[model samples]
Target chain A: MIKDITLGQYFPGKSFVHKLDPRMKIILLTFFIVFIFAARNFVSLGIMAAAVFAVICISGVSPKMYFKSIKAIIFIVLFTACLNLFYGTGDPLWQWRFLKITQSGINTAIFIAVRIIALVLISAVLTYTTSPTDLTDGIERLLKPLSVFHIQVHEIAMMMTIALRFIPTLLEETDKIMSAQKARGADFESGNFITRLKALIPILVPLFVSAFRRAFDLAMAMESRCYHGGEGRTRMRVLKYSKKDYLALGASCLIFAGVIICSIYLPATVRTGM
Target chain B: MKFIEVKNVVFAYDAAEEGEEPKTVLKDISFEIEKGSFVALLGHNGSGKSTLAKMFNGILEPESGDIVVNGLNTKEESTILDVRKSVGLVLQNPDNQLVASIVEEDVAFGPENLGIPPEQIRQRVDSALKSVDMYEFRAHAPHKLSGGQKQRVAIAGIIAMEPECIVLDEPTAMLDPQGRKEVMDTVIKLNREKKITIILITHYMDEAVQADRVIVLDDGRIIRDGAPKKVFSEVEFLKCHSLDVPQATELAYRLSSSGMKIEGTPLNETECISAVIKALS
Candidate 1:
């Protein structure tokens, strides 16, 4: 049952978007998430939609993946959209006891639904192109400034890297332990909630024990490799930005300017989005 | 000159009882490894070979006396890091020792720890991967490789550090026959072409036969120390220590005892074959 949880969700490709620097991709995503919510009216929302469309097109990923991401977050999107249906103050389109639907409420519900879907799709595109390891590396690079505030950025990054490295190994180990228990007639399926929870104890205890053992072993291995708290340590694959990153940064900055201009100059009454 | 010097070193495990004496694992052990020499330390279980290997790199310090690694004493705090930098130790399990997910990243791990420049680290990782013939898999995950390949990668990790000496403690014990041969070949290539001091600790007599010198440990003491031919020739002594000689060496030992006229004890198949031919002729 645990086998289906895809940890990385990485879709390997060589599209222009995929080839962009990870730090650049992350910075782009951050701007995207903020500007998306900062959008107040139709003009900025259209611009955000155009940006998402451009990323999707340049990414060369099949549209099926974006839909799958939307499917995964469908419940939250529907719940938020339904909640927005009762929110805006405007003419009632449909009336019920303590529940009246306004025309603006219908518009706001659509806007909220589309916003949630776009958020999921944009983040999905990031994960699909960038590997988990590279994603963590990008995060570490972005968080490098946080070290000035006495945060242990490098340590967190190392921990993240090690955790990512061990996931597959531990999953394989869990599969083995589960099979061994199953062979001895330990029923995992066809049980009540409590019974299923009880059956998990057999699996969880051994998994925890082995995980601890692996941790101890990895700690020793790190010491043998002369790992001393990441002080002055260098990496084989250094993260460096290229021309593509610069181009993406410029394009994103221009889009942000457009978004801000549209939000201010464009009147709220021109409410095509909501 | 000696690449490593151990003089009157003693090590003991902590005593469990308040009044009881500590259980000694290594007692008054003294040895020196010549620079660029291939030496095999042979011992059965509980003979302290692994403990001795750890002490060489300052992983475990001796309880008494002093050991010097490339002019740095293992006893000093500041020098211990230098000693480790100079003398790399590859333990038994490759899986446990590999720190990086990628092959080349793991290879560069040791040099990176030493604070080598990024460019130099790149060059070293490339060369080290090539040395182990694992260059093609540099981008592949370390867990995806076989036991032999992983051990080779581990060796490459040690080699990238440019350590003057490498001490492998039963590196082949967990490998299959083919993996064992793979690692042995890599170790031999490193010793011959690179002229790196190699100290291989194992009970495998075939591996010891390939070494320039074999030092046998029994009950935490050196029972025999000499060339492989000289040491394995004492078949009865080795047998008493619960150790076996290489098959050809034992064949010669058995045949001669059965009234076959073998010239001398042969250390390997080639020597044994020629000796038998000479005797028949």
Candidate 2:
């Protein structure tokens, strides 16, 4: 059951989106995020939604996965949208003691809900298409400029790689340790809040001890392979942007510009509670 | 010529508590491993075999002796990289040694660290995977692989660096019998075909019997060192040190003690069968 936790879930594919350079994908994702926020009226929001939908279709990941991602944050989305419903001040339709739903309240609630859903779906496109390693590599390259200030960018990237590599291993170990503790009659399920927290100590102690041991062995193994640091080190998988990446970047920028222009020209149908 | 020379190596770990005596792991240990030879180091737990394996790759510096790998003294800070490049050390646990999520990426880790160009690293990674017969699983996640497959990938990671010698410290200790066999076959093939020197530290006498030479350690000191046949022939001495010889040697030793005469010690089953049959005839 614990194995089902899909952190940074990526579906491997030969789709155009998947094949784009990860750095370009990250940049395109940033533009899409800005475009979503820049959207002021229904016209601009609809256009941004259309652009996101097109990219989602191109990503080749099933719509089910995107829905699943949205389902995870459905509570927060609904809660915030509900709070925005009563704050709108235009054309009150229904009145309560301290809460009044206006004509624009419904409009504002729909806008906020749609925006949050669009944000989740669009971000899902980025993660669904890019592998974790590629994403980290892209981030490392993007942050490479920080190294000039003695930021140890390479060290951070290495830590990320190792952490990603060990996630599954540590998860499996946790499962095993939990089972061992259960077999030894350690009750974890029936305890109260504080007792449940205390029950975790037995599992956490062994897990930490094993993690430290694994870390020591890994350091020695890396050293034996002559890993001194990132200095003068070359990467096996080089990130090179292709024509498709440039094309994708151009398209995202154009879409953002269009969204901004539409937001400026269109009459505000929905009150944006900024 | 010797690929690795350990001269009177002495190593000890500082006491964990105050007023406690230091724990000496290895003492006056000396041995020479020839180029392109398969050597097995045999010892029980706490015999310092793993410590000696680390010393080969300059992972742990000797306290009072010298270890020279490929004519580079490991004690020299500047030559440590060169020393490691020549003698790659594979640890006991396969899970801990793999640094990358994917098999091929992990193999490329060594060459990448050495600053090999991307194209060459790719070629090295592919060929190294092929050598270990793990090329088909290049895209497979390491955690998804079996213990034997992971160990082979670990070996490929070392091979990608093109190390002249590899010191494996009980690599199959955590594996099943099948996995142990797989690693042994890989190590033997690498030594015979690739001309890479192999020093395997294992407690399995059967595994040691396959090696060209066997060195037995007892309580931080080398008790015996010679060809496998010669060392296994000294069954009484090995047993006294709490070490085991091959099953065949043990059986022959038992027969000899039971008032039956066995001419030579057999290191494997077939030889033991032949010796027993000859005696019966």
Candidate 3:
């Protein structure tokens, strides 16, 4: 069941979106998120949704993946939409004991739901197209200014890279430990909550021991490779903006400006009610 | 043309508790590795072979003596990186050694650490992968690879650094038979084709037999050091030191001891077969 997780998974593709520089992609995503929240009337939200759909199509990732991401957060979408349903101040569309649904509430509920879905889909597009190492590298380069404050940006990136590299290894180790424990007649399937928690002790102990051992081995290996912090280190896969990245960045800026303009000037017929 | 020289080196780990004595791992070890030599270090667990391996690349400091790699003293802090650069170390566990998720990226790590330019690192990564015969899997995730493949990638990571010597600490200890053969083949190829000095620490007698020279360590001291034939022929001496000789050598020794007129000891399967045939005829 743990193996089925699609969160933060990268689907390799030859799409232009996948070819865009990761730093540029991250910048474009930031612009997108700002515009998504800044959107006011339905016209602006519609434009934002259309923009997200266009990127998702261009990303070449199956629509099913976006749906999977949305599905993972379905509970949050429903809960927030329901809470917004009764809080808007407008003409009552329905009335019942403690619950009065307004026209504005209906609009707000739909607006929030669509907004949430757009957020989920656009972010999914970023992760789906970019590899994890590229994503971390993009983040590290983007956050380079933080080093002025002694934030250790490179160290953070190094830690992130190592963590990602070890995730699958650790997961495999966990699976092996669980199986080993199971072979020794340790039951993890049937028990009360506390008892189940107690049953995890056997697996956890060995997993921790092995993780520490791996960490030591990795440290020694890193030293042997002359890894003396991030100072004087050069990257093989350096992030550089290409013509396509500039074009994509420009296109994103235009769309964000268009959303803001449409929200201020468009007719208020389908306005977002909150 | 000595690539690495160890002069009476000794190493010990600190005491685990305040009242306990520090445990010595390597005791007054001295050796010289010529350029392009293939030397196998043989010892059982805790016999200081691993400790001696670390000393070659300055990963561990000797408690009393000195180790010089290509004339750079390992004791100096400034030359430590240079020492490591000249002598790449391939560790036993392949899974723990790879730093990058992707195979090529992992191979590029050593070069990147040395601050090589991006283009040079790319070329090195490619060539290193090709040398290990893993170039096709350059973009594949390391975790998904088989044990032998992962070990090759680990070796590629070391090879990309362009080190003159490589010291592997029982690299096949965690691998299966096939994985062991794969790693052994790669190591031998590197030694013969690349002319890189190889110091292989292993307990496997067959692997030791394949080396140009075998140095046997027992209880933190060298017991035998010579060519494989010269070393393994003393089967009784090796057995007395709690080590095993190659199967063929043991059989030949037993046969000769049982009063069969075997002309000489055999160190491998082919030699053993010939020896037996000659004895029977």
Candidate 4:
């Protein structure tokens, strides 16, 4: 049901991975993603996967949940694997009248699939440990240097926080309107494509009206509270880097360097014509 | 000093088309609410009770006349924030007014907007939640809460702003009977303990009976203003305006008509019981 749809979901924990500064986690996540794409061969891919698995374990989140997070992209993973298997040009290992699978094709398919899985798992690890508010706080702090260019970092962060705050409210409103319309015998299900779409109008119109009303009320309330675009605003929980964050950052940097070296020095698999 | 003063205020919604008569919602409304007083506004639908409440905080400016709060004119744009800060407004629908997912964060919203330092904001939020007895649910999502709990949280949000007066526009309208009683008790407790002025706009006669003074509105005009007993005593006038006195008051009026002597009008069940017992003695 709708209750199970967790938005910006973060699992709370007290592990070293969870305790690291959010800013450092964000930076490390970005570095991890870049290095994921930089991975050229199986040796580098193995190193990337190992590093992601270690973090995931240290974070204390079950591996099943991490895979479940990537469930939505299962189709993309399979589709890319299929594309790599057939489109890769090399000596054919298996052949039919018009279809062929080469030695290079098998290697390419495994490489692409592992890369996609590794990329997704690493990103999930970052979100799994970092709460949405902390993520925004970290981003705002990281982007503080951009303020010299007159960028409104705090405003953007506040906007994000507000947006996160309203998601549940909006969801609840949508549910209410849907139920109200249903009570009036407005059919939302069991209809043709166009009929079902037309039925949505009753639910949608009221939802939009209520949303706009809430937005206006919230804006007025914010103004009354004297919010004037985040100038001279001080935070309650200021982001301060700790020793744990420094150590995590150092470890991530080492992993990044190690992956690059492995991709260059490690022996890559070779395929000869069948 | 009067915490809120309305002087000959007139307000209207602009007509849908040009050259058409505007819909006058409040016609020459005037009232003064002293600090720490509880005033209830009672009327049928379209009685302009809500319009008057909005005007108190400058949410809707008067078309003519002035509204002064703590000696500051609400018409002055510069003092509008000060006026709003002095008087908090809570709307009927608890769902619409709450802007935060978490209870504590919603309570912190008003003070946070005031740019109070984070530490002070935390204290205000905690105290506001404690005042409403919602401190335990500080981290819980508001949508999962019951109607009465959400309404109380909404009140807590307003209380966190630390306003001198709190104007509620039919806050219990959407709640069940139990929820209504919970909300009313919370309002009464805040007025009693915090010494905050209360301007309650409601249609429920039972609720009006608990206020220090009741102002009845009819078609954007104040038809009656006095204590609940005095106002309900004019049963004929109230009925003419498509309203009714509380059941106990009506029963007492019937008993008095049937050759029984009652010293005063009974606005509630206990009062009626006491009057009946005294009359028998």
Candidate 5:
């Protein structure tokens, strides 16, 4: 089903990763991404892979669920790996017309493939663990410093969260509209690209009109609830850093520091010798 | 003192085109809604009832006159938020009104904006959900709920703010039969048990029968204002204005108009049935 797209979807549970504060998970995800990019050798990449696996295991989410995120970026991963295959610097293994694949190209391809997988899985763990509401609150809290610049951080976060909440509703509405048009014998699927684009005009017009009407209604409701601004607003689910959060933070920092040290001191020592 | 005071409040929408006249939606409307009263505002489409409900919460300021809610004039800039705090308004579309995905989180949206303490906000959300019997669905997504349940959660959202009065403008208009009853029961319970004043704007004559006072509007004017039995008894007056009376009241009126001597006008089913039984006896 179209609703079953697993990207950025969360599963509610009380696993160790889910129990961590959203802010902590967000921060850890940032460090995890950096660590993945910093690893240039097999050992450091293996460490990155191990850390992601550990998070997935503790999160109690199926590895298959985490793999679903990769499906979304498979094109980019394949493109990059294919591009790197002909650009390696050492010992050309196959030569074609004006193109060659080297032993070092194969090694670099493997490294990048691991990095991409680790990066996607590490971020998937974040989304899979934290609900969208908590994620928004965490983002608002993290960006509170931007308020000094007079940026409307809370408003932006509120907009994002509302948009997220409406995604499924709007998608469902679109599905219904498509079906209704189909029932009326409106051809949507068999046409050429331009004709297919033309077919969507019926759906887009009503969707836009309804969306504007909903925006007006929502604004009135918000005003009725005494929403002036973020100045005096209080939150029900207050974000806090507990002992587990601190422990998770400490572990992420250790791994980040280890990767940085390894990258600086052992760049060529642990290279994959494929 | 009356909970809400409207003094000849006048409002109009902007003109649609150049040289076109701006349409007046509410004109010279003056009424006082007392504290803890269940008043239903009944009007047909374009009768200005929804426009009047908006004025009560300062969503639309009157062009000429004034509206004071809980002793704060909605005209003053500083008092608008405070006035809104006292007079919470629920709207027609249940889907648009809910901001949070989860039930409890959506309930918390109101008090959170009011700047309540975290612990107190939690308490209010819990109590509000319980009052609406939606406590079990606290963690459930609002989108997944039935239309009636969503409207109930919307009411719970207003209740969390603990407003003295709630103005619901066609809240159950989009709800199914069962959902409408669920919302009406919650509204009545809030009024009777919690003593929260209710200003319900509806076109459903049956729902208006539950109100203590029914105010009828036509052409942006108050055509009738009285108890439900008294107002619904004026069958011709309402019919002329393109409005309806409750089914029982209409039947009773039909029976009376046909030369039968029905002693009393019936506003609901029980009263209608009993009146028929008495006439037979």
Candidate 6:
């Protein structure tokens, strides 16, 4: 029952978007996010939204899945829109004795909601198309330049890779330990706040113990294979920039430039009293 | 040549709290397993079989003795990696040793750590999966596999490393009957076909009966070391050490005690049945 939570999940596909270099996806996603902030007028925001929807369609991942990702942040989106609606003041459109909704307030709410939606959709597209390992590999390659600052990019990547590798393992362990504890009559579903928390102790204790044990074993196993630290380590699947990736990058750059131009040239709206 | 040589090894686990005396786990254990031999270590709980297995790969340093693996001392830090690589350890719990979410990735983990070339790692992963009949589940999430399948994947991980020897510590302890059969079959096949040395640590007497050699551990010492027939022949001695003889061996022992004429000891069900028929005739 706990497996259906698909936030930040990857959906494997053979679409052109899914086949693009993850490094390019990372760059393009960054470009997309920057353009999202650069969107000042409805025309630019609409263009950006259309581009995201197009990418989503090409990736073959359902819009329903994208909305599922957005659902998690729905509360935050609403809260931000409400805050913007109440705080901004200019040309009151509706007035109650002490409350007022102004023209500027309505504009601000719309802008904030649009920005939130754009941000969520663009980020969701990247995650939906890219696998966790590919994303980590892209990050490692992109951050390889940080080695000049001795940031240990390989170690960070390896850590992320291992963490991603162990998520399912640890989840399975948790499930097993939960069942074991349940068989021992350790109730995790009933009782008050403290009682439930206390029940979790048995599960958590074993899970933590097994996690540490696994870490030690894995470290030993890795060291046994002469993993001295990613120095001069070559990956099995080397990242390569192909023509498709170049096209994707070029298209994203054009959209980003258009957004910047629109943000600079778009006229500011002036509100009159209602 | 002896692939693994342990001489006068002693080991203990230090209590976590300060000012506590270290508890001895293995005491003056001595043995040598030759290359390409399948050996089984059998013992009741707390008999120190696991500690001895750990010493084979230098996971635990002997307190006061020597363990030489493939012409390298296990105590030396420099040779530890070599020892471990030479002798891969598959722990008892199938869940703990698996390092990746996908079966293929888990199989690739060992080769990746060894810094094998990507192409070679891929090939090895494929062949290793095929060796354990898990090739079809290459892309499947390992968490979704049954206990037997997961354990097979774990074996494939070690096999991908291309180790000369594999040590399994109670690989079937948590498995059901079918899972146990699957794992045991894989271990035997790896031993026979790949010529990888197998050191299986198990409590099941039936599992030990198939080994080329069986060594019984009791209170941190080797009580019996011989071929399965020789070891099972001493039924009273095994029972005294808190270990059981194979049921067939027990039945044979019972028949012999009752003054029936059975030619030799039986360590397997088929042999015991034949012995019973002979006695009846």
Best-fitting candidate, scored by TM-score: 2
- Which residue segments of model 6 deviate by more than 4 Å? A3-7, A86-90, A95-100, A169-199, A220-227, A268-274, B16-20
Off by over 4 Å in 2: A268-274
DockQ, every prediction: 0.52, 0.90, 0.88, 0.44, 0.84, 0.49
Q: Considering summed lDDT, which 10 consecutive residues are worst modelled in model 1 chain A?
A: A265-274
* lDDT minimum window of 10 residues, candidate 2 chain B: B233-242
Write candidate 5's Cα lDDT for A194-246 as tens digits.
99999999989888888889889999999999988898899998878999999
TM per prediction: 0.92, 0.97, 0.96, 0.90, 0.95, 0.91
DockQ for candidate 1, C-alpha atoms: 0.52
Q: How well is each residue in B1-281 modelled by candidate 5, as lDDT tens digits?
A: 59999999888999999998999988799999999999999999999999999989898899999898878899898878888888999998899999987889899999999899999999999999999999999999888899999999999999999899999999999999999999999999999999999999999999999999999999889999999988988899899899998999899889888877787779888999999888778
> Which stretches in model 5 have alpha-carbon errors above 4 Å?
A1-7, A93-98, A269-274
TM-score of chain A of each: 0.95, 0.94, 0.94, 0.92, 0.90, 0.93
Error of 1 at A37 (Å): 1.4
The full ranking of all candidates by DockQ, starting with the best, is: 2, 3, 5, 1, 6, 4
Go through the candidates in order and give the C-alpha RMSD of each one to the true structure.
2.8, 1.5, 1.8, 3.4, 2.3, 3.2
lDDT per residue as tens, model 1, A160-203: 87877677677877889999999999999977999899998999
User: How many collisions between residues are there in candidate 4?
Assistant: 2
What tens digits encode model 3's per-residue C-alpha lDDT throughout A93-189? 8889878998878788888899989998999999999999899989999999999999999999999999999988888888888888999999998
Ranking of all predicted structures according to TM-score, beginning with the best and ending with the worst: 2, 3, 5, 1, 6, 4
Model 4 chain B weakest 10-residue run by lDDT: B93-102
Q: B1-281, model 4: which lDDT tens digit per residue?
A: 67788889899999999999999999998888889999999999888988887778787889999999999998998888788888888888787777666778778777766668888888888899999888999988887899999999999998988999999999999999999999999999999999999999999888999999999999989999999889999998999999878999989988998989886999999999999999989
- Cα lDDT tens digits, model 6, B212-232, are 999999989998899998988
Clashing pairs counted in every model = 0, 0, 0, 2, 0, 0
Models ranked on lDDT: 2, 3, 5, 1, 4, 6
Between candidates 2 and 6, which one is better according to lDDT?
A: 2
